[model samples]
Target: MKYWLGLDCGGTFIKAGLYDLQGNELGIARRNLAIIAPQPGWAERDMPALWQTAAAVIREVLELFGIKATAVQGVGISAQGKGLFLLDRQGQPLGNAMLSSDQRALALVQAWQKAGIPQALYEQTRQTLWTGHPVSLLRWVKQHQPERYRQIGSVLMAHDYLRYCLTGELACEETNISESNLYQMARGRYEPALAQLLGIGEIVAALPPIVGSAEVAGRVNSSAAAATGLLAGTPVVGGLFDVVSTALCAGLQDETRLNAVMGTWSVTSGISQTIETGFDHPFVYGRHAEAGQYIVHEASPTSAANLEWFCQQWGMHDYRQLNQWVAALPKAGSQLLFAPFLYGSNAGLGLCASFYGMQAFHQREHLVQAIFEGVVFCHMTHLKRMLQRFPHTRALRVTGGPAKSAPWMQMLADVSGLPLELPQVEETGCLGAAMAAMVGTGAFPDFTAAQQALAPRLESVQPDAQAQAAYQHKYQRYQALIGALQTLQSGHSKEAL
Candidate 1:
């Protein structure tokens, strides 16, 4: 009757899932996250509101299943990476947390690139400069909000902030911080020189001590216990980045297999035993859920979120009709194209989301199809880059909202010319976090063992030989358009609109 609890805080939803040791999902509950955007190109979440949302869902799941708080073994969390979540000098929330999709630091990133900052540090950080990175946002704060910068007490990402909320202990999980550009990749620890290099030397002390994935971060204190229905002193493990959680749940049994996550961000990742660098385009590396391993990836804020934006605008919530529209269209003959960069871009800085080559004959369905393909195309851009680094890559383990669609999954497989692996994981973020909890609570020796015992059923979507040829041609057009668009992006800013 032992159980593990996982809380997934995502940009779109705050989900809580309860699972047994055998990986059976006992219950799940979710609440849509309300993103606060006071200015254009800004995405934020109120800290207190976020914690309340998480508490509400956690309580709902426990009550809905009638599970005793004492019966739950441990708790783990999985959340979006690289957003600025802070606590001021009094250990109170500073302001609304900046999301990974926020573009307020676009000008700073561009300025740094012109100064060859990213290029100079790429050998050490192994990450390209991005507007949404914590360093970028922190620099923006130090220059623009000097008072708040001086008042800084601690700097943390979304998951770290949540872990602190649960346990009242200040810790930085290694996996998420590895991608923050504040940590030295090769040395596998925080280096103050990196902070100085990024122009935020004063905030070095704010970086908390690092903790391993399966280690006990802290226990749920009385405050969190009363807020949520959990018992006091329930152990909480150092959680994971959502992508890391998804990879473990997707059954990435070996290095040959890759994982693609399509959500608020389109992330393509592969695991490596040793760190590899020296790429023309730097691939971001984060500490793996497993000790001594690394997860190398390329990601952008271009994915199914595009559909969410359309849903908000058109006032439609369901996906069946959109899939049907895309399903009706033939794959190869469409002349329309879409750049899925509403939130962020993979091509380069300051790229706007747009539909190109639209004709009078195009209908709403055609536009929907273009959106699907545009998202897939953006994912492919990252996938193609990853394949160069992971040349031995064999299969893709896919997950996320878009993967639920047969038409969309088929498009991804056909475009990549590789077989798509769909694991029977309903909530990857939750299940992945549970895996960490299981390990921390001594349910398994490590993540690999935990996954093997709870391995999910598998479904495969193979590429079509005929469709692959057509997709190769279509992908060429997508690449050409991206090239043209990048050329026209000189001095442009997404926030300018």
Candidate 2:
């Protein structure tokens, strides 16, 4: 049977999935990729190693399923957004791949804020200045690693780099690069003035041509065929930003339901036909895989990773037990709150992850409950903003590691007062990448057709009225506490008033 291959390059893992035209999962495989941190606030990966990991996972999935490379008709990819991957003048890995979690550009972001660059460009770019954004990272490199900066030949994101390795092509998929702050959203092209305004005009030459997500990028080349065990002439499509992949896999075809992803970054995304900005906070917009659509989202590095942090520290993995404990607790009575900003902050920078209102009576289980609630609270912050734009949203399609926990999903539902659907797919990224392939290869006419052909199996969660009422009061306190902290953080309150 003819199948498609999808490579999903996440922050810490690279996964491959094999799918039939009917959207049935034929087989899947994954490999953990190393996250190299030579210094605090610096996250890098070996680019060549990343490519090998992609190849290895693809080969393993094909071999494990007893499928031939020639049987795979099309290939697509989705990966973490905004990481810096570069090829030198020699068409080799520049130095090390910088990850989206990397904060080497934190100070540069602060400087930009002081200089009003974000405000100047917000109407055009629609992305907030962040440490991990390619715009910030490029400036940081020019100042700190000038040697490496000078050798830049091509700049791309993780999936874009992997696509290059497989197809020997240089291009930026629209969904990823649209958020890079290099591209002008309304103009539909990269404006050199943006690079010049950001003081990185010299590196604009490194940016590649833009490619649409479901368009054929190139054919897998002979060397890649030998390395990945794929047919040399297999068509490969331009890929997606990981968040877009998840949104598509969750079947977010319109603004009726928001897609909430609770991974390393907590994200709430909605699909719209036109650009909508001018929010109390910055809302990012990305080109959607579907033609004439845009994905508007608010995200941060605050999400399920906080639970992972607690798991690592306390040597606990009994999520079933931990979740039971959380369910048993009284949600309204707990005064405890966690910031969930261990990696990055949505509230603002210079704020660290912390717990408030802890008492002597609070136990480890209580702390676990606080961690879960804190992450949900952070997501609510983003969700509330999204709801302002998509006011008719009736439900939330939630995805990620935390969605598996009943307590967590229910908490999100109660807090948002919207029904939530948890997708059963093991890897939405891989599936969405495959959907792109399906559309590119004419298996489906467009993204909407692909969605109808492969709707995800979903489980639902309804909000508890009592819990919603309680959370309403608790949420006020939550906002008050965040405002108090912000007053202490910047001597100015974050109250919406």
Task: Choose the strongest candidate by TM-score.
Answer: 1
Residue 173 accuracy (lDDT) in model 1: 91
> Model 2, which residues run further than 4 Å from truth?
491-497
TM-score of 2: 0.96
- Per-candidate TM equals 0.97, 0.96
**What residue pairs are clashing in model 1?**
none
Tens digit of lDDT per residue, candidate 2, span 1-497?
A: 99998899987678999999988898889898888999988899999899998999998998898999889999999999997998998789998989998988877898899899999988888787889999898999999999989999999899899999999999999999999999898987898999999999998888899999999999999999989899999999998899999999898988898999998899999999997656576778888999889999989899998988899898999999999999999875688878888888888776678889999999988899888888888898899889999999988999988888998889998888899988787889999999999899999999999998799788999999888888888778777777777777775323321
Where is the poorest 10-residue window by lDDT in model 1?
A: 488-497
RMSD of 2: 2.8
lDDT of 1 by residue, 337-403 (tens): 8899999898888789999999999988888888888998889888999999889888899999888
List the candidate 1 regions with Cα displacement exceeding 4 Å.
491-497
